[model samples]
Target: MCKALSLLANSQNLFVNLARVAIFIVMIWIGGLKAFQYEADGIVPFVANSPFFSYFYKYEAPEYKNYKNPEGKVVAKNIEWNKLNHTYIFSYALGVVICLIGILTLLGIWFPKIGLVGGLLTAGMAIVTLSFLITTPEVYVPNLGGDGPTPNFGFPYLSGAGRLVIKDVIMFSAGLICASNCASRILSCCACKAK
Candidate 1:
């Protein structure tokens, strides 16, 4: 037990590196998916509602609700609407940015200066994503009338989208951690050079 504890304790740096790798993997996979039609369509609510991003779309919030394309399903009119809104174009550009951030983060394994920038960008991206929880109405369960008043249809109650957005908190922390680690490395190099 003591041996295992010691090994685990000694592996902090390894785990941090692993976190960078994990970030890289997640960013790459999710970013890559943005190029696809379904994935691009899925982000409409968040983007359309976001004050920071709503301008990217031709239509306004709530307008996108009418054009949603469920995963694995498609309708021509909806596609045409999305095209007019430049959904795919925005998504492609976002994907490229995400992929670049991931690459920069992964490169942090060796280049502390670059890694620091990457880590900060990762945190920034996560912050933007987390903002969707507040800006996107879809993030919460709506009070859709049913047999009676829905017991859980607001604030504290999280819909699937809310749950998804909430998870960005982890990415935010990891990005800070990576940034700190790189900063430490950079400082240490500077100190050694002074000697």
Candidate 2:
């Protein structure tokens, strides 16, 4: 039992570091993608469906709901502006924030205070992304991808993007772990110096 516990304790730091690196990689990659117009177009549903985020767009709700994808359905200038906002104003902004969070969290590996701040920001973003589960019905697609039956309401299923959003929960946990470990180590070091 003692040996087993010791082994688990030894592995704890490894898992924490993995989680940290995962957060860093995810943020940097996603943030980089946000810089592209195509990636901006891709996140439309998640942003438009979100009550908190929908207001960011100048267009009305129906415009977004009716907007089609990849079939030459560009109807008006408003749509173009909407896409621009998604790319320039919203997605890019979010991307930068996420990248910053990841960078800060990763920095915690060397600088405890900086890492704690980053951990807090990462945790905050995780909370925001997780909020999409409640606001974005698009997260759940109909069985058969929207052609199953008459009035087939999709529920109890997470769409691909939704699953991606769901992964933030893990990141949130990791942020807490990073912060906790850093704080503990800092306190321990300070205590040893005092003695």
Candidate 3:
């Protein structure tokens, strides 16, 4: 019984280590992309076109156009645009913060506490963004004239907007995993000392 328990614990530790490593790699990649604007044409362009990216653009992108409300009786004005430099600085700062958190988490330097905080922030942002996208009626129709009327695609759940909504849910789950006890549970099993 003792030997079996020991073996199980070791296996759990190995799994946790692997997960941490994977998370680190992904974070580094994302952070680098945001910081350097590397490959903006490749993945960035595709993601920009994606429903998930649309939410980001709606709130953050100055070039995004505003649309009339569902009633079509009133035209919506564009939100005030911040200066390009200000927006870039804010975005870069956010990327740096996320990168730092990811690095600390991967190191297991702070374990549950920092991990929990980082995960919570990530999850919160995703949820809020998701909610905004879900509630908005306007769908982003790429390549259409910027000032043209909004397109009408029936069935809210079947539209491209739906894809963005679903993607946010998946992203939220990933954040939850980082915030939850799964990592700690595995660590405990391995007899690894928690930070």
Give the winner by TM-score.
1
Candidate 3 lDDT? 0.50
Misplaced by over 4 Å in model 1 are 146-150
The C-alpha lDDT values of all candidates are 0.93, 0.76, 0.50
Error of 2 at 51 (Å): 3.8
Per-candidate TM-scores read 0.96, 0.80, 0.48
- Against the true structure, candidate 2 reaches a TM-score of 0.80
lDDT tens digits by residue: candidate 3, 104-194: 5565524666666655655665685576454444333344344548554444533464565556565466566666644565567568654
**Candidate 3 residue runs with Cα over 4 Å from true position:** 1-19, 37-63, 66-85, 135-165, 182-195
In each prediction, how many residue pairs overlap at the backbone (N, C-alpha, C within less than 3 A)?
0, 0, 1
lDDT of 3 at 81: 33
Alpha carbon deviation, residue 79, candidate 1 (Å): 0.4
Clashing pairs in 3: 9-190
TM-score-superior candidate, 1 or 2: 1
Output the worst ten-in-a-row residue range by lDDT, candidate 1: 143-152
